[model samples]
Target: MRHPTPDPPAPGQESVWDYPRPPRVEASDESVEVWVGGVRVASSTRTLRVLETSHPPTYYLPVDDVVPGALRPVDGATWCEFKGEAAYFDLVGGGTSAPRAAWSYPRPSRGFERLVGHVAVMPGAVDRCTVDGEVVVPQAGGFYGGWVTSRVVGPFKGEPGTWGW
Candidate 1:
Protein backbone atom coordinates (compact mmCIF):
# COMPACT_ATOMS: atom_id res chain seq x y z
CA MET A 1 0.00 0.00 0.00
CA ARG A 2 1.07 3.54 -0.71
CA HIS A 3 1.96 5.66 2.29
CA PRO A 4 -0.15 8.67 3.20
CA THR A 5 1.34 12.12 3.10
CA PRO A 6 2.65 12.96 6.56
CA ASP A 7 1.38 16.02 8.31
CA PRO A 8 4.10 18.60 8.61
CA PRO A 9 5.26 19.03 12.16
CA ALA A 10 5.21 22.45 13.75
CA PRO A 11 8.21 23.74 15.61
CA GLY A 12 8.87 21.70 18.76
CA GLN A 13 6.75 18.87 17.36
CA GLU A 14 7.56 15.58 15.63
CA SER A 15 5.89 13.79 12.74
CA VAL A 16 5.21 10.10 13.32
CA TRP A 17 6.07 9.27 9.73
CA ASP A 18 9.68 10.02 10.44
CA TYR A 19 9.98 7.30 13.07
CA PRO A 20 11.90 4.15 12.18
CA ARG A 21 10.33 0.94 10.88
CA PRO A 22 11.97 -1.46 13.36
CA PRO A 23 11.05 0.90 16.22
CA ARG A 24 13.44 2.55 18.64
CA VAL A 25 13.40 2.73 22.40
CA GLU A 26 14.48 5.87 24.17
CA ALA A 27 14.37 6.93 27.79
CA SER A 28 12.15 9.87 28.71
CA ASP A 29 12.42 11.94 31.84
CA GLU A 30 9.02 13.57 31.31
CA SER A 31 6.61 12.75 34.09
CA VAL A 32 4.28 10.03 32.88
CA GLU A 33 1.18 9.00 34.74
CA VAL A 34 -1.73 6.65 34.28
CA TRP A 35 -5.04 6.78 36.05
CA VAL A 36 -7.70 4.12 36.02
CA GLY A 37 -11.14 4.32 37.54
CA GLY A 38 -10.26 7.60 39.16
CA VAL A 39 -7.26 5.94 40.78
CA ARG A 40 -3.71 6.79 39.93
CA VAL A 41 -2.25 3.44 38.99
CA ALA A 42 1.15 4.42 37.76
CA SER A 43 3.54 7.37 37.74
CA SER A 44 7.15 7.78 36.84
CA THR A 45 9.91 10.17 35.87
CA ARG A 46 11.74 7.36 34.13
CA THR A 47 9.98 5.90 31.12
CA LEU A 48 10.87 4.25 27.85
CA ARG A 49 9.13 5.53 24.75
CA VAL A 50 8.78 3.14 21.84
CA LEU A 51 8.74 4.93 18.52
CA GLU A 52 7.68 3.25 15.31
CA THR A 53 6.66 4.56 11.91
CA SER A 54 3.06 5.78 11.65
CA HIS A 55 2.38 5.46 15.38
CA PRO A 56 2.55 7.79 18.30
CA PRO A 57 4.93 6.96 21.12
CA THR A 58 4.04 4.16 23.56
CA TYR A 59 5.41 4.83 27.00
CA TYR A 60 6.56 2.01 29.24
CA LEU A 61 6.81 2.63 32.94
CA PRO A 62 8.88 0.58 35.32
CA VAL A 63 7.04 -1.96 37.47
CA ASP A 64 8.31 -0.33 40.63
CA ASP A 65 6.61 2.90 39.64
CA VAL A 66 3.16 1.35 39.54
CA VAL A 67 1.00 1.42 42.62
CA PRO A 68 1.10 -1.75 44.66
CA GLY A 69 -1.41 -4.44 43.73
CA ALA A 70 -2.71 -2.33 40.86
CA LEU A 71 -1.80 -4.82 38.19
CA ARG A 72 -2.97 -8.45 38.19
CA PRO A 73 -1.73 -10.97 35.69
CA VAL A 74 -4.50 -12.08 33.36
CA ASP A 75 -5.02 -14.55 30.58
CA GLY A 76 -4.01 -13.89 26.97
CA ALA A 77 -0.80 -12.81 25.28
CA THR A 78 0.43 -11.43 22.00
CA TRP A 79 3.68 -11.35 20.07
CA CYS A 80 5.52 -8.57 18.36
CA GLU A 81 8.15 -9.34 15.81
CA PHE A 82 10.27 -6.58 17.22
CA LYS A 83 9.56 -6.80 20.97
CA GLY A 84 8.77 -10.48 21.41
CA GLU A 85 5.99 -12.16 23.45
CA ALA A 86 3.87 -9.82 25.50
CA ALA A 87 1.82 -10.85 28.49
CA TYR A 88 -1.36 -9.00 29.43
CA PHE A 89 -2.51 -7.71 32.77
CA ASP A 90 -5.70 -6.45 34.34
CA LEU A 91 -5.44 -3.09 36.00
CA VAL A 92 -7.49 -2.93 39.17
CA GLY A 93 -8.04 0.12 41.31
CA GLY A 94 -10.74 2.31 42.83
CA GLY A 95 -13.10 -0.67 42.60
CA THR A 96 -12.63 -0.66 38.85
CA SER A 97 -11.00 -3.19 36.59
CA ALA A 98 -9.59 -2.86 33.12
CA PRO A 99 -8.88 -6.28 31.67
CA ARG A 100 -5.88 -6.69 29.50
CA ALA A 101 -5.40 -2.98 29.68
CA ALA A 102 -1.68 -3.36 30.17
CA TRP A 103 1.12 -5.51 28.85
CA SER A 104 4.82 -6.21 29.24
CA TYR A 105 7.53 -8.23 27.64
CA PRO A 106 8.78 -10.75 30.18
CA ARG A 107 11.65 -11.66 27.91
CA PRO A 108 12.29 -9.11 25.25
CA SER A 109 14.22 -9.73 22.09
CA ARG A 110 17.91 -8.90 21.83
CA GLY A 111 18.60 -5.18 21.48
CA PHE A 112 15.15 -4.58 23.09
CA GLU A 113 16.13 -5.86 26.54
CA ARG A 114 15.39 -2.49 28.06
CA LEU A 115 11.69 -3.36 27.85
CA VAL A 116 12.10 -5.93 30.58
CA GLY A 117 10.26 -5.05 33.80
CA HIS A 118 8.49 -2.16 32.07
CA VAL A 119 4.78 -2.04 31.39
CA ALA A 120 2.75 -0.19 28.77
CA VAL A 121 -0.94 0.52 29.11
CA MET A 122 -3.60 1.21 26.54
CA PRO A 123 -4.61 4.82 27.10
CA GLY A 124 -8.11 4.21 25.80
CA ALA A 125 -8.69 1.53 28.41
CA VAL A 126 -7.71 3.74 31.29
CA ASP A 127 -9.37 6.80 32.72
CA ARG A 128 -6.52 9.11 31.80
CA CYS A 129 -2.88 9.29 30.88
CA THR A 130 -0.52 12.23 30.96
CA VAL A 131 2.92 13.24 29.88
CA ASP A 132 4.59 16.04 31.81
CA GLY A 133 1.09 16.92 33.09
CA GLU A 134 -0.44 17.15 29.62
CA VAL A 135 -3.38 14.81 29.06
CA VAL A 136 -2.81 12.44 26.17
CA VAL A 137 -5.12 11.37 23.41
CA PRO A 138 -5.06 7.62 22.80
CA GLN A 139 -4.11 6.35 19.40
CA ALA A 140 -7.31 5.72 17.37
CA GLY A 141 -7.36 1.97 16.82
CA GLY A 142 -8.40 -0.20 19.74
CA PHE A 143 -5.43 -2.46 19.21
CA TYR A 144 -2.48 -0.05 19.21
CA GLY A 145 -1.34 1.50 22.49
CA GLY A 146 0.26 4.72 21.23
CA TRP A 147 -0.38 7.91 23.15
CA VAL A 148 -1.02 11.09 21.20
CA THR A 149 0.30 14.31 22.64
CA SER A 150 0.68 17.84 21.28
CA ARG A 151 4.36 17.18 20.69
CA VAL A 152 3.56 14.61 18.02
CA VAL A 153 1.78 15.02 14.70
CA GLY A 154 0.33 12.24 12.62
CA PRO A 155 -1.87 10.80 9.99
CA PHE A 156 -1.60 7.92 12.48
CA LYS A 157 -1.89 4.30 11.49
CA GLY A 158 -4.77 3.29 13.77
CA GLU A 159 -7.27 5.59 12.10
CA PRO A 160 -9.82 4.14 9.69
CA GLY A 161 -8.56 3.03 6.25
CA THR A 162 -5.01 3.15 7.58
CA TRP A 163 -4.63 -0.55 8.27
CA GLY A 164 -2.24 -0.93 5.38
CA TRP A 165 -0.11 1.99 6.42
Candidate 2:
Protein backbone atom coordinates (compact mmCIF):
# COMPACT_ATOMS: atom_id res chain seq x y z
CA MET A 1 0.00 0.00 0.00
CA ARG A 2 1.20 3.45 -0.82
CA HIS A 3 1.56 6.04 1.89
CA PRO A 4 -1.14 8.65 1.52
CA THR A 5 -0.24 12.27 1.44
CA PRO A 6 -0.42 13.89 4.85
CA ASP A 7 -2.31 17.06 5.50
CA PRO A 8 -0.44 20.29 6.02
CA PRO A 9 -0.09 21.22 9.65
CA ALA A 10 -2.19 24.14 10.77
CA PRO A 11 -0.70 27.04 12.65
CA GLY A 12 0.20 25.99 16.16
CA GLN A 13 -0.26 22.33 15.16
CA GLU A 14 2.17 19.53 14.42
CA SER A 15 2.25 17.38 11.35
CA VAL A 16 2.81 13.71 12.01
CA TRP A 17 4.91 13.58 8.83
CA ASP A 18 7.51 15.72 10.53
CA TYR A 19 7.92 13.20 13.30
CA PRO A 20 10.95 10.95 13.14
CA ARG A 21 11.02 7.46 11.70
CA PRO A 22 13.22 5.97 14.43
CA PRO A 23 10.98 7.59 17.06
CA ARG A 24 12.14 9.84 19.89
CA VAL A 25 11.33 9.95 23.57
CA GLU A 26 11.28 13.21 25.45
CA ALA A 27 10.14 14.51 28.79
CA SER A 28 6.75 16.20 28.61
CA ASP A 29 5.75 18.92 30.99
CA GLU A 30 2.09 18.87 30.09
CA SER A 31 -0.43 17.57 32.55
CA VAL A 32 -1.66 14.13 31.61
CA GLU A 33 -4.58 12.49 33.35
CA VAL A 34 -6.76 9.43 33.01
CA TRP A 35 -10.14 8.50 34.36
CA VAL A 36 -11.89 5.16 34.47
CA GLY A 37 -15.35 4.23 35.67
CA GLY A 38 -15.87 7.62 37.25
CA VAL A 39 -12.64 7.56 39.19
CA ARG A 40 -9.33 9.24 38.63
CA VAL A 41 -6.79 6.54 37.98
CA ALA A 42 -3.71 8.48 36.95
CA SER A 43 -2.56 12.07 37.05
CA SER A 44 0.88 13.30 36.25
CA THR A 45 2.63 16.53 35.49
CA ARG A 46 5.86 14.79 34.62
CA THR A 47 5.12 12.58 31.68
CA LEU A 48 7.21 11.47 28.74
CA ARG A 49 6.07 11.14 25.15
CA VAL A 50 7.15 9.01 22.28
CA LEU A 51 6.81 10.60 18.86
CA GLU A 52 7.07 8.80 15.58
CA THR A 53 6.19 9.29 11.96
CA SER A 54 2.50 9.04 11.07
CA HIS A 55 1.51 8.56 14.69
CA PRO A 56 0.33 10.77 17.49
CA PRO A 57 2.45 11.10 20.58
CA THR A 58 2.09 8.35 23.18
CA TYR A 59 2.35 9.73 26.69
CA TYR A 60 3.95 7.77 29.46
CA LEU A 61 3.26 8.53 33.09
CA PRO A 62 5.56 8.03 36.01
CA VAL A 63 4.57 5.10 38.18
CA ASP A 64 4.46 7.41 41.16
CA ASP A 65 1.44 9.36 39.90
CA VAL A 66 -0.66 6.39 38.99
CA VAL A 67 -2.90 5.29 41.82
CA PRO A 68 -1.67 2.33 43.75
CA GLY A 69 -3.03 -1.09 42.83
CA ALA A 70 -4.22 0.18 39.47
CA LEU A 71 -1.78 -1.70 37.31
CA ARG A 72 -1.48 -5.47 37.40
CA PRO A 73 1.30 -7.04 35.36
CA VAL A 74 0.08 -9.58 32.87
CA ASP A 75 1.59 -12.03 30.44
CA GLY A 76 2.59 -11.35 26.84
CA ALA A 77 5.18 -9.14 25.25
CA THR A 78 5.53 -7.05 22.12
CA TRP A 79 8.68 -5.84 20.44
CA CYS A 80 9.58 -2.44 19.06
CA GLU A 81 12.81 -2.23 17.19
CA PHE A 82 13.69 1.11 18.72
CA LYS A 83 12.31 0.58 22.21
CA GLY A 84 12.81 -3.11 22.83
CA GLU A 85 10.42 -5.51 24.59
CA ALA A 86 7.20 -4.22 26.09
CA ALA A 87 5.16 -5.94 28.81
CA TYR A 88 1.43 -5.56 29.18
CA PHE A 89 -0.51 -4.51 32.26
CA ASP A 90 -4.18 -4.58 33.11
CA LEU A 91 -5.75 -1.50 34.54
CA VAL A 92 -7.83 -2.56 37.50
CA GLY A 93 -9.23 -0.22 40.10
CA GLY A 94 -12.13 1.99 41.15
CA GLY A 95 -14.82 -0.47 40.12
CA THR A 96 -13.46 -0.72 36.63
CA SER A 97 -11.11 -3.06 34.84
CA ALA A 98 -9.49 -2.84 31.45
CA PRO A 99 -7.51 -5.86 30.45
CA ARG A 100 -4.17 -5.27 28.78
CA ALA A 101 -4.90 -1.60 28.96
CA ALA A 102 -1.39 -0.41 29.61
CA TRP A 103 2.18 -1.31 28.74
CA SER A 104 5.73 -0.58 29.83
CA TYR A 105 9.24 -1.38 28.80
CA PRO A 106 10.83 -2.95 31.86
CA ARG A 107 14.19 -2.81 30.11
CA PRO A 108 14.09 -0.27 27.34
CA SER A 109 16.72 0.02 24.65
CA ARG A 110 19.63 2.39 25.08
CA GLY A 111 18.00 5.59 23.87
CA PHE A 112 14.66 4.79 25.47
CA GLU A 113 15.90 4.15 28.98
CA ARG A 114 13.62 6.86 30.34
CA LEU A 115 10.59 4.72 29.53
CA VAL A 116 11.69 1.87 31.73
CA GLY A 117 9.01 1.13 34.29
CA HIS A 118 6.82 3.98 33.02
CA VAL A 119 3.28 3.23 31.97
CA ALA A 120 1.54 4.28 28.79
CA VAL A 121 -2.18 3.52 28.78
CA MET A 122 -4.42 2.95 25.82
CA PRO A 123 -6.73 5.92 25.66
CA GLY A 124 -9.54 3.72 24.42
CA ALA A 125 -9.18 1.52 27.46
CA VAL A 126 -10.10 4.30 29.83
CA ASP A 127 -13.25 6.35 30.11
CA ARG A 128 -11.21 9.41 29.19
CA CYS A 129 -7.64 10.58 28.84
CA THR A 130 -6.37 14.12 28.60
CA VAL A 131 -3.13 15.87 27.74
CA ASP A 132 -2.84 19.44 28.85
CA GLY A 133 -6.61 19.55 29.35
CA GLU A 134 -7.31 18.42 25.80
CA VAL A 135 -9.17 15.13 25.61
CA VAL A 136 -7.19 12.46 23.80
CA VAL A 137 -8.45 10.63 20.75
CA PRO A 138 -7.14 7.13 20.60
CA GLN A 139 -4.91 6.31 17.66
CA ALA A 140 -6.77 4.42 14.97
CA GLY A 141 -6.55 0.64 15.21
CA GLY A 142 -6.24 -0.62 18.77
CA PHE A 143 -2.64 -1.68 18.44
CA TYR A 144 -0.86 1.64 18.91
CA GLY A 145 -1.21 3.77 22.04
CA GLY A 146 -0.80 7.16 20.31
CA TRP A 147 -3.16 9.89 21.42
CA VAL A 148 -4.54 12.37 18.91
CA THR A 149 -5.28 15.89 19.95
CA SER A 150 -6.30 19.11 18.21
CA ARG A 151 -2.69 20.14 17.99
CA VAL A 152 -1.89 17.34 15.61
CA VAL A 153 -2.61 16.77 11.92
CA GLY A 154 -2.40 13.36 10.34
CA PRO A 155 -3.26 10.88 7.67
CA PHE A 156 -2.25 8.39 10.32
CA LYS A 157 -1.20 4.80 10.14
CA GLY A 158 -2.99 1.76 11.75
CA GLU A 159 -5.89 1.98 9.30
CA PRO A 160 -6.68 -0.69 6.72
CA GLY A 161 -3.97 -1.17 4.04
CA THR A 162 -1.55 1.27 5.69
CA TRP A 163 0.44 -1.21 7.71
CA GLY A 164 3.27 -1.77 5.24
CA TRP A 165 4.20 1.90 5.30
Candidate 3:
Protein backbone atom coordinates (compact mmCIF):
# COMPACT_ATOMS: atom_id res chain seq x y z
CA MET A 1 0.00 0.00 0.00
CA ARG A 2 1.19 3.50 -0.76
CA HIS A 3 1.79 5.61 2.31
CA PRO A 4 -1.09 7.90 3.09
CA THR A 5 -0.32 11.59 2.94
CA PRO A 6 0.24 12.88 6.46
CA ASP A 7 -2.12 15.53 7.70
CA PRO A 8 -0.48 18.88 8.32
CA PRO A 9 0.08 19.29 12.05
CA ALA A 10 -1.24 22.54 13.39
CA PRO A 11 0.74 24.46 15.98
CA GLY A 12 1.36 22.35 19.10
CA GLN A 13 0.49 19.17 17.21
CA GLU A 14 2.50 16.22 15.95
CA SER A 15 2.04 14.12 12.85
CA VAL A 16 2.34 10.40 13.39
CA TRP A 17 4.01 10.03 10.00
CA ASP A 18 7.00 11.80 11.51
CA TYR A 19 7.47 9.19 14.21
CA PRO A 20 10.28 6.61 13.93
CA ARG A 21 10.03 3.15 12.39
CA PRO A 22 11.66 0.94 15.02
CA PRO A 23 9.76 3.15 17.45
CA ARG A 24 11.13 5.57 20.04
CA VAL A 25 10.45 5.37 23.76
CA GLU A 26 10.62 8.59 25.69
CA ALA A 27 9.51 9.86 29.07
CA SER A 28 6.22 11.74 29.08
CA ASP A 29 5.09 14.22 31.75
CA GLU A 30 1.52 14.28 30.52
CA SER A 31 -1.11 13.03 32.93
CA VAL A 32 -2.21 9.60 31.72
CA GLU A 33 -5.31 8.06 33.18
CA VAL A 34 -7.31 4.88 32.60
CA TRP A 35 -10.81 4.07 33.69
CA VAL A 36 -12.54 0.74 33.55
CA GLY A 37 -16.00 -0.19 34.72
CA GLY A 38 -16.51 3.28 36.10
CA VAL A 39 -13.37 3.00 38.20
CA ARG A 40 -10.23 5.03 37.75
CA VAL A 41 -7.75 2.19 37.68
CA ALA A 42 -4.56 4.01 36.78
CA SER A 43 -3.17 7.51 36.64
CA SER A 44 0.37 8.79 36.35
CA THR A 45 2.47 11.70 35.24
CA ARG A 46 5.59 9.60 34.92
CA THR A 47 4.81 7.56 31.84
CA LEU A 48 6.57 6.47 28.67
CA ARG A 49 5.36 7.25 25.16
CA VAL A 50 6.12 4.90 22.31
CA LEU A 51 6.09 6.54 18.91
CA GLU A 52 6.23 4.69 15.64
CA THR A 53 5.57 5.78 12.08
CA SER A 54 1.92 5.86 11.05
CA HIS A 55 0.67 5.17 14.58
CA PRO A 56 -0.49 7.42 17.36
CA PRO A 57 1.50 7.46 20.58
CA THR A 58 0.98 4.60 22.98
CA TYR A 59 1.41 5.51 26.61
CA TYR A 60 2.88 3.10 29.13
CA LEU A 61 2.09 3.78 32.74
CA PRO A 62 4.15 2.57 35.68
CA VAL A 63 2.65 -0.42 37.44
CA ASP A 64 3.02 1.37 40.74
CA ASP A 65 0.65 4.09 39.58
CA VAL A 66 -2.17 1.66 39.00
CA VAL A 67 -4.71 1.01 41.70
CA PRO A 68 -3.95 -2.02 43.85
CA GLY A 69 -5.56 -5.30 42.81
CA ALA A 70 -6.66 -3.90 39.48
CA LEU A 71 -4.53 -5.94 37.16
CA ARG A 72 -4.58 -9.74 37.19
CA PRO A 73 -2.10 -11.77 35.18
CA VAL A 74 -3.55 -13.81 32.37
CA ASP A 75 -2.42 -16.47 29.93
CA GLY A 76 -1.09 -15.80 26.45
CA ALA A 77 1.60 -13.47 25.18
CA THR A 78 2.59 -11.51 22.09
CA TRP A 79 5.93 -10.41 20.77
CA CYS A 80 6.95 -7.04 19.44
CA GLU A 81 10.12 -6.95 17.36
CA PHE A 82 11.11 -3.62 18.84
CA LYS A 83 9.95 -3.90 22.44
CA GLY A 84 9.94 -7.64 23.38
CA GLU A 85 7.48 -10.24 24.53
CA ALA A 86 4.39 -8.93 26.29
CA ALA A 87 2.35 -10.71 28.94
CA TYR A 88 -1.35 -10.04 29.17
CA PHE A 89 -3.38 -8.77 32.08
CA ASP A 90 -7.06 -8.73 32.90
CA LEU A 91 -8.15 -5.37 34.21
CA VAL A 92 -10.65 -5.75 37.00
CA GLY A 93 -12.43 -2.88 38.70
CA GLY A 94 -15.86 -1.79 39.83
CA GLY A 95 -17.08 -5.38 39.62
CA THR A 96 -16.26 -5.55 35.93
CA SER A 97 -13.47 -7.31 34.04
CA ALA A 98 -11.74 -6.69 30.74
CA PRO A 99 -9.76 -9.73 29.72
CA ARG A 100 -6.35 -9.14 28.26
CA ALA A 101 -7.03 -5.46 28.36
CA ALA A 102 -3.51 -4.59 29.37
CA TRP A 103 0.06 -5.79 28.70
CA SER A 104 3.66 -5.17 29.63
CA TYR A 105 7.09 -6.36 28.73
CA PRO A 106 8.61 -8.11 31.76
CA ARG A 107 12.06 -8.04 30.13
CA PRO A 108 12.20 -5.63 27.24
CA SER A 109 14.69 -5.69 24.40
CA ARG A 110 17.76 -3.50 24.53
CA GLY A 111 17.06 0.23 24.01
CA PHE A 112 13.47 -0.42 25.07
CA GLU A 113 14.18 -1.35 28.67
CA ARG A 114 12.09 1.55 29.89
CA LEU A 115 8.99 -0.45 28.96
CA VAL A 116 9.67 -2.94 31.69
CA GLY A 117 7.31 -2.62 34.66
CA HIS A 118 5.08 -0.27 32.67
CA VAL A 119 1.67 -1.26 31.35
CA ALA A 120 -0.28 -0.19 28.26
CA VAL A 121 -3.99 -0.64 28.14
CA MET A 122 -6.36 -0.97 25.18
CA PRO A 123 -8.58 2.09 25.29
CA GLY A 124 -11.32 0.33 23.36
CA ALA A 125 -11.44 -2.46 25.89
CA VAL A 126 -11.82 -0.15 28.83
CA ASP A 127 -14.52 2.35 29.61
CA ARG A 128 -12.26 5.32 28.97
CA CYS A 129 -8.71 6.57 28.72
CA THR A 130 -7.40 10.11 28.89
CA VAL A 131 -4.19 11.99 28.32
CA ASP A 132 -3.74 15.30 30.06
CA GLY A 133 -7.44 15.41 30.91
CA GLU A 134 -8.65 14.93 27.31
CA VAL A 135 -10.57 11.79 26.46
CA VAL A 136 -8.72 9.70 23.87
CA VAL A 137 -9.90 8.03 20.73
CA PRO A 138 -8.60 4.53 20.25
CA GLN A 139 -6.59 3.93 17.13
CA ALA A 140 -8.64 2.30 14.39
CA GLY A 141 -8.88 -1.50 14.39
CA GLY A 142 -8.79 -3.42 17.65
CA PHE A 143 -5.25 -4.79 17.65
CA TYR A 144 -2.89 -1.87 18.23
CA GLY A 145 -3.21 0.17 21.45
CA GLY A 146 -2.24 3.63 20.20
CA TRP A 147 -3.99 6.48 21.99
CA VAL A 148 -5.32 9.26 19.78
CA THR A 149 -5.33 12.68 21.41
CA SER A 150 -5.85 16.16 19.98
CA ARG A 151 -2.10 16.76 19.98
CA VAL A 152 -1.48 14.13 17.32
CA VAL A 153 -2.43 14.03 13.66
CA GLY A 154 -2.76 10.85 11.71
CA PRO A 155 -3.70 8.75 8.81
CA PHE A 156 -2.93 6.11 11.44
CA LYS A 157 -1.76 2.62 10.46
CA GLY A 158 -4.63 0.59 11.85
CA GLU A 159 -7.27 2.17 9.68
CA PRO A 160 -8.83 -0.04 7.01
CA GLY A 161 -6.64 -0.49 3.88
CA THR A 162 -3.54 0.45 5.88
CA TRP A 163 -2.44 -3.05 6.75
CA GLY A 164 0.75 -2.83 4.71
CA TRP A 165 1.72 0.67 5.81
Q: What does candidate 1's lDDT look like per residue over 61-161, in tens digits?
A: 99999999999999888999999999999998899999899999999999799999999999999999999999999999798999999999989999899
- The estimated TM-scores of all candidates read 0.98, 0.96, 0.99
Ranking by TM-score: 3, 1, 2
TM-score of 2: 0.96
- Return the lDDT, model 2, position 15: 90
**lDDT of the candidates, in the order given:** 0.95, 0.90, 0.95
Model 1 scores worst on lDDT over the 10 consecutive residues at 156-165
Model 3 spans with C-alpha error above 4 angstroms: none
Segments in model 1 whose C-alpha atoms lie over 4 Å from true places: none
Worst 10 residues of 3 by lDDT: 154-163
**In candidate 2, what residue range of length 10 has the lowest lDDT sum?**
156-165
Model 1 global lDDT (CA atoms, 0 to 1): 0.95
Q: Clash totals for all models, in order?
A: 0, 0, 0
Q: Over all chains combined, what TM-score does candidate 3 have?
A: 0.99
- Backbone clash pairs for candidate 3 read none
